[model samples]
Target: MTVQPNIQGQAQANPVSEIWYTRCPVPTTSGIAQHFRWIHQEFERHGIKVESIRAAADQAVRNSHYSHTQPASFREGGNVPPIWTRANGQDTVVVGITWVDEEQLILVRPDSDIKTLADLKGRRFGVPKHDTKIVDIARGQDLRGLLTALDLAGLTPADVEFVNVAGGEFDLREQGERREGRRHGVVEALLAGTVDVIYAKGAVSAALVVKHGLHPIIDINANPDPFVRVNAGTPRPITVNRDLAVERPDIVARYLAILLKTAAWAKENPTAVVKAIAAETSSTEEIVRKGYGPELHLHFDVKLTEQYIAALRKQKDYLLEWGFLKEDFDFDGWILPGPLELARALAADDAIKITL
Candidate 1:
């Protein structure tokens, strides 16, 4: 079964408007409320206020990566968390906390000779916008796979096609029918017979698997270790809105602190968190226990370090090789850790008080 995000409450500060932190759900991030109960106790004594919002993966990443940025702008790719490097620029966070799962690469057409990933050389490929970024990240280690992607073609651009689809957001099927500016619309060309393959995201992935006769040549394994890839190449999240950050440093830091603590609590209390999350997720108590509940190995800390920064650098390189981001881009500059670090320092007084 597919897990859809829950759209919960908005923050309403009536009398004491000063809150300690706010939170957003990481895309596909399971079992948070389980830990929030404990995090809430830590803030209660501090008179800190807490808030939460939820949505699909990317939206969730954008909104909650910070406590202050709940309902954050969709355009701000800047606030991406380190935990999600494979997609949404989350390489800096510990691996396995949030991971990329593949549904396999399948041929949607009958005459398609793209039987194996290596057979697709010079053949056209399509990536619907829905889970484009994440999927790209999942395929990060497969650069050589691109050559095999082009229709088993020993042919160059003149020999085959790389179709462009203007897909819509969230829904992959509507990608072709959606407006040009809409995200994930990159698959229309495929639908119109202009391209050979359609690489799509979730809803689109499901649609392609059913209607278009999708076939799988790629193996999507859960990346167990994201940190190993981190090197000097990681892109630091940039705070381009200099004026906003400078003007509201305190609020920003406090918000980040809250999220850090939330991540920490979530990592520390897996069983409790998973049970609470079980209330929202599709997994059973037995599954949660068997999967992520302890035997699953989830982490509790959210601290960034040289190791994490390095991992991001490696991912940035992968993006560059794929022409997704600039090759010379300085990931270190993009990472805005001042607020998080400051919050961490101030958080010395922060105690873990909440219980299951």
Candidate 2:
């Protein structure tokens, strides 16, 4: 079921004198970025400053530019902000949620003899390069999903020979870097028969199966466990810096209210939303349309639902078990419900309608 507040009313006319910065992990070409872009003025109207700079999990590390930027509000695909914050001795609190269970597919060439997970044993598995050191958990999601699937099939990494395939880098040439690369190198590797089996993500991956006749051998989306789902690229959490959460919670609530409004607007205008995303990402309309699928249509609620907390804890535990975490912290304490709670309360009051 979808949940959205009635945002057709007027936004607050009086602007509070507070300067706050917000950032979303979605690339400029993605739907999330488009929605954020559309609501830029709305956030400003509420006296909240929006940080238009796009920050990736790879860049939100200790001593990185994103970490130093100190955005008061942020959104990320996984439990990345929490992980990075804990590792860097920085304090941040997660306040809002947007659940999206993404699809990660295990594919094989149509002419290949490999037909099932069992057939993948002793075969060359093409893995797009993933950074697992201090950052880049976002890129590692598919790899972790692939590993979980292998384990479920009574296989291990030792059973397959891993082939390295080029993937996107955090360094953008637009920032005047010398390197330029495509993010779909895995698709290229598969088409060229560089590997026997591969793990692919999003619309481009889906297109390979539909148009190029690649065989989808294993569907990770079929798995029902939250442990698997957490890493599948859903459960986007909106976080706030600890100081902001404590010092100026009202500003944080107002920021979250704007996010909810944007989601509601997008829900009511799917066509425009899709077109905006397609144009921004330089992807074809068809690819952008199919990329969202059912996962991205979920409710963007600010409440810290019980299911969300459980899924987040499961992710933290699994990451620790997999040695991805250096140490454990209080996962429960990482969530602060005050701002979202305040936002919901404000939305319920008809005496106070929000104006854009």
Candidate 3:
């Protein structure tokens, strides 16, 4: 990030302004970056600026050039503000895709003899990487809770293996060799057919599947049931920062409205959005198509409800227990949702409908 001499002080716009946002590439592309771009393109008046840069988590920390960025989807959980800071009981919302199982790959295998999450006992569990494990807790971040839940459902990791693969990074490389190097040279070492399964976001899973011939036997979408997300249930989450929330309430409201609209639009026109995104990055049509989820990632259930808040705070407490946090953070003060609520109000108003 080059230091642009402060040519202009506090150039941030009034009711609207451009704000840089970075997303960590856990599997392949960034869910957060994609989530916001449609917002920026569909709604520019709310002064929300969007820069969907997909960086490795390590690189993202080094280049904190943006005014605001989403928490690493797989963050280890920290005491940092915005992370723990609360504003009017609504500071930010966390919404992303997750794949839950009793024991990772073992429990979530594409070709397994077992039928449900309970089938794998004493089996192995592997994620694409460590952060993937961290983000698993976004629903609760509680390893024990997850374990217990799995047990009740019927399984135990004490019975199997655990592997960590990092192949998605190759998708973002100056060339794909870096990614291929890890998948073929390193990951292949463990694929002697002993490992049961692997769990990763759509992009990551797709990368390995396309590159290494891995297949997904179980589509978390199998049951007649809708997929479940911890923090933001059916509607999903939209975690925004606090400083931006109060100082520019107007911008926040408009930004929220635009983003929500964009998310809706992306569903109907994914091919167009994917093509535009692919043109800018080395990502291919296949990567974009595979990385892209249902119009709104239909697999998972999302919502801005109490269930979501409880899930977020539950993870916070678990973070404290894990010693990743200094102290317990209050849910009432750690997150802000004022702008979202305001936007909902406007969306409901008949008077506002004429202009919309």
Q: Could you arrange the candidates by TM-score from highest to lowest? A: 2, 3, 1
What C-alpha lDDT do the candidate models reach, one value each? Answer: 0.38, 0.57, 0.39
On TM-score, the leading prediction is 2
Worst 10 residues of 2 by lDDT: 172-181
Off by over 4 Å in 2: 1-38, 55-71, 130-134, 166-169, 172-181, 207-213, 224-226, 279-282, 350-356
What digit string (tens of lDDT, one per residue) describes model 3 on residues 197-293?
4443334445666666654434442333322222111222344555555555544454454444444444456565566444433356575456444
For model 1, how does the per-residue alpha-carbon lDDT over 164-250 read when each residue is reduced to its tens digit?
A: 444322322201241212322443455565666644332234345455455545422122444432211122232213232333444
Q: Candidate 3: lDDT of 282?
A: 38
Query: What ranges in model 1 sit over 4 Å off?
Result: 1-113, 128-160, 168-194, 200-213, 220-261, 264-303, 314-330, 336-356
Query: How far out, in Å, is residue 75 in model 3?
Result: 13
What lDDT does candidate 2 reach at residue 131?
43
Assess every candidate by TM-score: 0.48, 0.76, 0.57
Return the number of clashes found in candidate 3: 31
Global lDDT for candidate 1?
0.38
lDDT of 3 at 216: 48
- Candidate 2 clash pair list: 10-354, 10-355, 11-354, 11-355, 29-281, 100-234
